[model samples]
Target: MKNSNLFKITLLFSAITLSISTANASKIDNDEFTSLQYLDKVTTDAFVEENKNKEFYDVIVGIEDDQLATALLTNDRMRKALEVGESFMYKGQEYVKTEHLLNVADQFRQDIKSMLGYDFHVVQTFNDIYQVLVTTDGSEEKEDVLKNLIQTGKFTYVQENEQMQLMGYDNEGDNKPMSVVNPSITNDRHYAEQVYFARQVDGYEGAASIEVAKQILSDRGVFASENKVNVHVLDGGMVPHEDLDYAEAVDFKYRNHQGKATDDGVIWVKKDFTREDDQYVSPAFDCSGFSSDPESENATSWRPDPPPEDEADEWYRYDTNKGLSLNSLHGLQAAGIIAAKSGNGVGISGIIPQENVNLVSALVVDKCSGGSADIMKAVYWSIDNLESPYAIGNSSYDGLPYERTQYPADVINMSFGGGNAMCFKRSNNYWTTAWTQVVQDADEKGTVLISSAGNETTTTFNVSPAGCENVMSVGAIYENGRPTGFTNFGDSIDVMAMGSKVWSTSGEVVDAGEFDVGYGPVNGTSFSGPIVAGLAGLLKLADDNLTPKQVVDLIKNGAKPLDVGFSGGETTCGWLGCGAGAVNFENSVRILLDGEILGEPKATHYLADHKQKDDSNYISLQSEFNPNLCSTYKVYGSVMNDKYEDLEYTLYGQVGSGDYEVVKVTNNSNFTFNKEHDNYQLSACNATTGNCSRNVNVELDSSYSPAACG
Candidate 1:
């Protein structure tokens, strides 16, 4: 009987060994699994060594399946992988959908206790992914704990949460507040100060092209406001400002400050104050706890504070600098550029002048710095929160109440970026995988992601999320259309826009009286990013069903060539260096709506020596006409001569294929001719040099107008 039992046990063991070999062979043959193995071989050891000594590490753990995560948490094998610790703390809200996991939550906790001897908590949870902040009081190294977690083969990847920087900068020696009033087509107070709203002398069509596109849409009876588009600006906190309209504003900063209170029941107010019960009453503070402060009884206000210098200074109740509050300046400026209130005779006009585009400020950055984990959380939240405009739902998740808009973001403007090299398929590191996943997920949800190409003025191949796939990277250009000295460039850039001296609503508070308001000029690719994001919002407003790829393609195809090359003096921007060129909102819109390119008007004239003249008396007569005023269009011709005075000239006009007709004859230096045809050509010539001005073609339609023709 014993011999028979031994033979049966041998057969059972052989069957188990065969099953294990088959599973390993299958995984090895799989391309994706093989790639993961290769990545593990190179990056695992280096990552563990690099982060071993930190006080604590916030690591993003990605799991291939939600079931696997639950199983790993309760698995006995996983509990034996590492030594148990004494104690630890986990913070942040967790969203989970598995009921079985909830039932086994105690088991999972016990398992964690046995594995790391620390309290394990889920900080935040994605669909099948989550983040955890690990701390241990035991002898085992934190990095070793992470290595053991990786060795368990339960997570898809694990990497430290990195940080990203805001991509804007103040011009060297030009940081003063903007005071110049340059007039634009709009009646807003600072409309003229927005240089991107008008064409530059160097032929760079600025964001002003959007105005023409708006007109075209209006003529077609397709108004932008009727089809509202939501744009989420993922940046620093947004203070209450007059110029910007927010669909929803969320403060993701840590809620650790203690509320200020007095014995008489006055609470500290961080926002604007109002009158109540015959007295000026401020909003109730939403803080952790109140402290009795008799000295602040009469002072029931809170001021904006500067960034902390160290960990000890991070927690504060009020402004210590007593200077301008730069808390939300970057975010406010970006929001202003995208969808500031327009035509209200307010501060300035946004790309979309009306209230059609909804702006959501996802405050992921603290002051000007933000971690990768928080950014990814905000992005995922935005994606999941996309719902019908009329459907009422709770949009708050992190203990903040934010109203649910018509939808999530049709386009997310990330005016911040960091890191070197493309984020995907380059290193296969944990951070790269997480970033790539977020960007890809956004794309899958039809949300176009746009980011600044950075201000490093070097190859953008090293900058991300700009270098990441599915992200439309933007570079900065001067008002004259040349690439900014500090704007990063390379194959990663999708387009360029006006970034130098661009004026928008500022977020600085000069004094306590001026609570949440200001306007000024700032420089950097940071501003350039929102300009394109505004354009994307308009594109979605024009056609709510357009895919993210289509929107990017249309923008690229409609872009105009830059005034200069990426390196300067090169005539045009190369495809890999400066993208498809400068963004032309009008042309992009026209191409989408009309399926054709309506070229802008052009006229060229130069002085040349004539054989019959001894003193080079070349007369060049240039005519200027307003193409926007249809039916009452008039061309005013002016003559310039080297020697001749009051030169006589004749203006000729041809309608379609008709013969040239004398539209005007004058001996004076200036003459005017009324346009009488929808399509016509005009030229001016004098008998002196027998030279004629270059012919200018004027095309007028209900939706096609160039504003000016020369």
Candidate 2:
């Protein structure tokens, strides 16, 4: 009996061992490797299904947790295994680390590739974060599979679409939930009182570019001393080691970087605010472009003129006569919006009343490729060198792919959007994810982000940067209280500001011309973003104790809604499209001071629902509530404030659904004083006197209601 039991036990043990071996072999050794192979397929499928009937521009994936980032960055064997440019498949995905960065990101990229796929591309290798660009195949099937892969436990977080991240607008599926910032808990809006602004000026190349902004800022009351807005405009590239050391040098609270300096220490016009004559100037440093030429009258005159060596301040041309001319207006436009002084009769006014701003400028655009590498370098420089208490930066240029590894400013302004991603055969999903990480990081760092809603009128699509959640997406409203015809509309738009036809400094345009008040006609959400930034600056000035979100909510809720359609019937939904309506500066200030909370408006009472007859005329509903029952009630459907005029409504009494009973009432009071009923069934009468003149009916609204008549 004992022998028989032993035999049975042995058999059972063998069976269990066999089952374990089979499962392990299938997972790690089998050629099919079905479990790992299906990951990419599942992710693709999930991505496709998740974005069904939806359009996007890119796909972005979040790096695994810190633990994973550490392992990937420190692994040497993985780096050794990677070939210069060879792409490899890991698990179900494919990835290839750039040969240039293999030493830094090889292990990280390899691990992610082995787990996610080889199609993943590394964005920033230094930081613990390993952002991989998951190529969006633009197929619904692929999208679904991608979604599933991200949802799986294998990867920590996956961003299926990059465009969604860029716009900051979150779909229901975005796993990341924004933490609501309670303004009540936080105090001191300007956390950092003392800060530094440093700029890298490529020696000899960008002399005029750096000086113009410095001089202009000086004129506006901001000087480059330790006591003032502490502006450090360096005229050299702080590269690899020096860059790292510079990061260690400053006790930073805030930073402003300008100009991209190449490794050769040459200044270039990678990106700079340009005047009308194409002159380039940096508020900080200016880098050299691909080509160098003496400032000439040629069409391709982007080359920077080499300055005299060792004469730093001598090269600085304080006179307006010498500014490099560049074609791009984005950077200059952004600066103007930030600190342009008003009443100059120049261009338009900036968000702040005074121009005392320390701009940490950097030229990050490559003259040859027009890429954003230089800009990334500027961000790195700011992170290391700046010492300000609160750092607020702005990026007026757009159309660049989102790079999550780049600098995360406390407040970054993005005003540009919309390119034919379809025409380029690019999915905007990846861009969205990168932008999401930006906003997420900003939240972590207690920063605020603002963006423009974009100016795509022909197509019904929200623009990038604005679509991302956690970002304040602003749309343009004309000075006349009308929504600009070009401002993009969607649920993602958060607020509206005066963007259309704003007047401000024209930079070199005004320099060449007689106009000191450089004003020009500018439109789009780009202008709108600066307006918000300016408001934010003012809010900080007022209280200096508000959280980012508190300031945002205060600005949003305090704003007054515009009458007519959002921006005067430009949107399909008009009034509805205007998010929280238009901004009201005075009201917002009042709200902040008083700390009052207004409840949501009560639902509109409709006697009947019907189509419209014309633009001005509309169907009327019978009085659902008797206003005359009491002394008075605020009819809060649509009340325009001092900034705008109130819309007049013609209250008509209809016998039923179809019959019309037009009534005329005085426009002064909410009660619609002295309105006469068309059917003579209801009439207008004096409350104090019994005098009646063909205007009386028991069924009519007494005074303005049926109860008043009774």
Candidate 3:
């Protein structure tokens, strides 16, 4: 819908007069827009003119809410000028174009250009927001241009585009030798190396139990292939790998602008890049001639030859050491973790079976860094391409119109974050507003958004997207069930997952000097986030109607608390800092299959003798209950020390129904009507989750005596 209005303006505007005025400069009174403390002003007037023709700065402008309605209405004259339908649905929403709104927007654009003396181009538009790239042809400084745009009161906010980075850490230094292998985990070639799925590794029990969950689903007659869910990975481009399956892959790294002038006297023509002849280009490092382009021939003949084939596998592992690297296969690695091909006798298995997921690769990152505008565009694209409720409609972009993708994404995995950016509204940052709006839009569609909690090892207080409300932020945990040293912690994190030396598909050829393998180890919260995302996919498969909030709750409710100081060690992790706990995929699956936790509450009963004030002996019966990781237990039922003689005298205390209360003998002593009778009945229920446990009957050991109570 927004794109339609932008297209109408581009075609209808041919030329316009410019009027520069500084009278409205003092009109910037909105605290939300004026309180931006992060933006630094450019003080050097000479520097602005020095680089006037050499640099182009991208600024994002948010249109005020009042203007959005005027921009959406279509008029008779404007309808005839565009020669299109009066109203139509785009991405499941209806929009109408108007000439009055275009004129107003065009006038504002002209006034800004006149004031700055610089060329402005609307690179992209979404939800009444504009990402305009300002070419440095004008003598006005960049900071002054932003202030002038905000002073008009027509825009909600205006700020420079910032940069974001992939959250994964390539821990190649800790990589294991290719020759090393463990066969105990599974038949998959690298299952053992994927320690995140193990029940217990290195004396710690923090595994996600992915294999166990899959088995549970199979036993319940729910086959993996029955799962029909789409998962979109928003990261660097995914390369062509035999271990991964893709429903669609699009690159937003480059956009070609064909300098053209609109009616507003503004040049605005930028088209998204398309692959050459629909050929798939691997984003991984090229080993052929050490060039980013694998097809390129080496200028010099000194490039090393590709690696030799392995005798056992009969497959050649390309030489990563020989080529110039393009970008880290961050997206590919994350995809492999989420939905790599399973049971094909190839690399490791994904958390979700390949047949169960339709992986959509939306490559927004180029090299290791990405601009905010590109990331935002990718977000909009992913949302728009989802299977819509109505018949898909054609939308125009830079004069070229196309149909939307029918595939829908139930879960979007953003394994990247900007630690320097804050997503809170109080910060009064435009980036925060932009991210929050996008996340809210995704939430409205019931799409689960999961992002890494960052790897700064501090707190996620200032992290973007992760800190945004309604987003499930995941932290990293070690095999020993302790929070990873590098994982950002605090109240913002929703849950924890294994992220230490995780083994997954590598973009570059691993072990180039020894052997060729495309799989290797990486460390970061980036990988941890995908594990939870894959589990969310499986949950969606179980129930398609589950909302994003419900999905997050299921995972958190089924998680196991971390073993902060196991074996009486000094290590400790607080509940607020460590998250809900380590995600247990198997437990989460069982919770979905059954109404409550799978196991019963553990409780023990003991008998002892106590001496009364008069030196008389009385038998004491005590019951103790221990809570499990999934929930807390509340013991229920009455305890009768002497069932036959003391029918009227009983030790009974029922804390409020379903309340978390400890049930025990009152005052550790009850008047004994008959010491010979010491039988009691009790049951426990999960106080935290409201799921009850089975009842148990206990009797004191027949050999025990009153002397033991001293």
Candidate 4:
């Protein structure tokens, strides 16, 4: 408890930008309180008595810098956690030299045994920290040992490891049943109708958007090539799914994660996925000393017995699933949405039908949940093994993207989100969390980050990665055209997609975990987010040079307005609104292809979304969304009509509620205001022209009077 240098450690933690979390995150109850008595015992007595039990606890050790990181890599108190090394990514570097690592690993353990009478070994290492599994005497709590160690001031933070659960649920849906399958729905040529959003977009005016995108791409000779896009699915391993084709994998279990998972210290692999003898040896699989888990069992084959009376445990067996495991179903279902086989007439269609997308599966989160550290490792692996002109990733779960991975990520889809957890918070330098900073770093690299608005039926800011700046957060809409009942909304969500009762392949359907098989229906912002991801892949495919900023614009502006919320009420289109509305799948692609030709309204012209009113004589013009009468602005004898009067802006103010009717903004609306009342909202439209912008609330430096606006 003597943390004399705690202040220094805190400052040092902030200065080093490796994106590690130092939150005092673990919780302990009094039942474990008795262990502290052992702290006063001889170091030898603690070690000898603890070693007698031969049980080891997984330990997380936090250090100060890369130098300490490098030292820990060679420290004895740390031993390789798993017998065999799984690929390890720390501070954005990969550690695969097993012989060297394990050799030094042994030496470090011996040194700790001699110096401190503690039998411990390293399981994982990062540039700024390392993990070791240590045996503790019954007298001292594992948490107590970690706590006292932190007090020595040699570390930034320490705590017991945390566990994760899969983020999935049975849809119990009726709209898109699992039992029925039609050839047209399954056929690649006619499967668009089976997909809720793949066909016609409700919000965008052009109903033929998808068909138009296909035709335009075809005319340009742009075809679907599995070789083109790289999509990483960081979930349970992709089981042997039939509808999903061309999936590559990197087993992220074992390695530093040790006892938490079934760690055989081996990454699993498949022949077709790792075909070296074939002409196009897919550059997708990880061959860098990393392999796959043994293999996963077909969930369809193992029907759990009828008796809840016979066993008191919950489990399922699989070859690759480490026996009774929460194997690859959720991961597979997500993959199906992105790249299921098309035109085979056996299963439901994926979003990018006809295009064989390269799916690089990283089993980062086993079952449904996993830690940020494991996710960081998988991201590094993907950056290394799957970088052909770069790629995008699909995270059906929520976690921060790594700030700096060895490779580039073009677009990352986080289809999962919720309120803040122990793992991330701005007070914890939320941005510095490797999970958060990585996305920001990816953004700098032009990697567009996409997240779910959440399913909490609340504002998205309550969520983490979604509310993080610059992410394309998505919400959900039901099949009947209502916003999904549980979808979280607010300005954080950029668009919506068909999420309720949409059919796709089921990973658990195959008897032997093979492809070309099972199908079912699902619901969630999870599905909505991926549909956007699939579209994003298409955007990158159509034009790889699309910047992250441009991607956000195309997605938001091209969407059709929903005009309603999950509660059957009209939606207020503002900073607290559900964004620009639902995803217009076809209009999105069309907008991308049309580029500047469309001359859509620009957000740039309406500066001051964050304009400081404290010093301004007159604040800059307010924002307005205008659809020109002509392709360009119409010119009649060099005179433009003041058409905006027909549709006016309603300005909401600092109170966060109530509306103020604003004068129609033609080009820009500038108003001189008292700094005291600078906080106000603004919105505009050309109702006659059927074009409008969402209501925007601006917080000026101060306040305003009615006369100031005129």
* TM-scores of the candidates in the order shown: 0.59, 0.44, 0.62, 0.56
Query: For residues 257-357, what per-residue lDDT tens digits would candidate 2 score against the true structure?
Result: 11111222223222233434646443322322111112211212122344456533223321111112222234345545555443443333334444333
> How high a TM-score does candidate 2 get?
0.44
Best by TM-score: 3
Error of 3 at 283 (Å): 12
- Best-to-worst order by lDDT is 1, 3, 4, 2
Q: Which of 2 and 4 is the better model by lDDT? A: 4
Candidate 3 segments whose C-alpha is farther than 4 A from its true place: 1-51, 54-56, 65-102, 110-120, 134-152, 177-185, 200-206, 255-326, 385-395, 398-403, 427-432, 507-517, 567-572, 597-710
lDDT (0-100) at residue 436 of candidate 2? Answer: 47
State the TM-score for model 4. 0.56
> Which one is best on lDDT?
1
Between prediction 2 and prediction 4, the one with superior TM-score is 4
As a whole number from 0 to 100, the lDDT of residue 135 in candidate 4 is: 57
TM-score of 1: 0.59
